[model samples]
Target: MIEYQTSSFSQDEIRQAAQIQIQELPQGFLSSLGEKPLALIFEHVATSQFGVMVIAKESSNNRVIGYVFGATDTGQLYKDFLIRRTFQAIRYFLPKLLSWDRITKAIETLFYPARKQQKRQDQEECKAELLDLAVVQDYHGKGIAQHLFGEFVEQLREKGVGCFDIPTTAGLDRAHRFYEKMGAIKVGSVIVHEDRPTYIYRYIIQTRKHG
Candidate 1:
């Protein structure tokens, strides 16, 4: 059996989640920052008021097997991370800035929300977003991801979010399929990092109206 709940941001649990993130998303930019820095990012998110991190654990062992984390306002999340984790962010990201390619990508990431707003002016802008979701390889096909996603969605709902967006690498067919299966509509695509295409999907939360 597996249990899922919002994370308390414990050091050990953050370490486990970071390990899973690096293992499952080796090519992601955050994973390139090394495990310790990645763990710091997880801790930051788990503690942020605008963010939510849900973890899945084995019932008997209480070992983290999966996690899904995102923010109620992605723009604010990034801004807050930069402001609150300034020293650590500089310590870790400063080294990566030495590479021209990485610098360009970082700039693009920093301005992504503004660019997205310009590109999708006709559509409703969704401030809320589902940033990352990952499950241990051994736990795949066990419905852990679904449970984690459900919990994250519930968190957003409780926060009164009407809709949210999910951006994933273009080639991740399994993830795309899962989002589609969960009723997320494909919105469009964008290039956030040079040479990498990302697909965007939006999900609307159906809230019942009280009579």
Candidate 2:
């Protein structure tokens, strides 16, 4: 059995989760951002005051099995945290500048038009952003992802976030299917490199009317 709870910004759990992301996911710059991926994840979680972090723990061992990270209102997410993470990235990647792949990847990551930042510029539509979601390999094929996303939508709804957006690479077919199943519409997409497209998906949460 697995139990879900809001994370308390526990470094250990976040570090464990980050390690999984680095090892399992093909994140261009994130893999090269810092010696410890946990630091970057922690910085974002800690600075994004109103963002959400949910953790799933196995009942038998009380170990974190999966996690989801998102924001309720992204208009202010980058206002304060961008500089710090950027500087950290620069510091870490400076030594590895000789690698062309690392250099190109860093440039791409820095300028990537993340949906949240774009939503902030709109100023009219209040949109939330699902930043990152991941489940450990061993925990795959379970409904943990669905449950986590369900709870995520509920939490964002409670905070008055009606519209949501997420950016994903074209290769993540499973994620595309899941978002489509959740009623998310593909708003737009941009081709970063040959055969590598970044698709933007948005989901609108219907608000309840009170009599």
Candidate 3:
């Protein structure tokens, strides 16, 4: 049977679980974060600071298989991330000169809600933002994403969530498809900021039709 967990652990636990080893440069927003590991800080930000839900699954053997993290707009952590990154990039990051401008533009695009939903804005309510989601490579195509997402939605309702958000772009083909499969419809988007061209997607969460 697939088991789900939402317990909290310290930063060290996140690092060990994510299995991230590279010591990324302290540049841009990352730089402002100082010596803390990125993965742990991110987990903390989502669960503790943002009041986001954590959906994770483990096997019968008790090994982690997948997880998704998200938070409400009250945190506004994304905006703060941008400001910190700007300073870090200028000071320490060695970004690809060509890709730098484009990346910045994409960040800006994710800020504003897609204009397509302007008419429905009055009736809709704000929900948590899905900040991160991932499954172990070996566990791919096993309905783990769907399982975790289902549980997360239930948890969201318990938390009084009315809706949720996801950040994606047309360029991120895989992510876009995943959201589509989750029954998320696009509400807004913006062109990535550069000659190379890119776009960001903003998708809203739809509650269970029967529930």
Query: Best-fitting candidate, measured by lDDT?
Result: 1
Residue range 1-211, candidate 3, lDDT tens digits: 7776665644544553344212222223332433433454455544564445443445456555666666655345555555545555444333422365545644544544443235336646454666556677777788877877776677676676767766554456776788778877676553434333233334444555773
Superposed model 2: Cα runs more than 4 Å off: 32-35, 73-75, 83-93, 96-100, 114-126, 192-195, 208-211
Candidates sorted by lDDT, descending order? 1, 2, 3
Best by TM-score: 1
lDDT of 1: 0.88
Residue 24 alpha-carbon offset, candidate 1, angstroms:
0.8
Model 2 per-residue lDDT tens digits across residues 1-211: 8888774656666776676566656464565554364456554764466677777778787687777777775545644456557777556447766687767764565455453356446444444678777788888879888887887887788878888878778888999998898788887765544348778788888897899
lDDT of 1 by residue, 103-139 (tens): 8877898888777777788888998989999999988
User: For candidate 2, which ten residues in a row score worst on lDDT?
Assistant: 115-124
Score every model by TM-score.
Answer: 0.94, 0.78, 0.61
- C-alpha lDDT of residue 27 in model 2: 62
Question: How much is 202 displaced in model 3, in angstroms?
Answer: 6.6
Candidate 3 global lDDT: 0.54
lDDT of each: 0.88, 0.69, 0.54
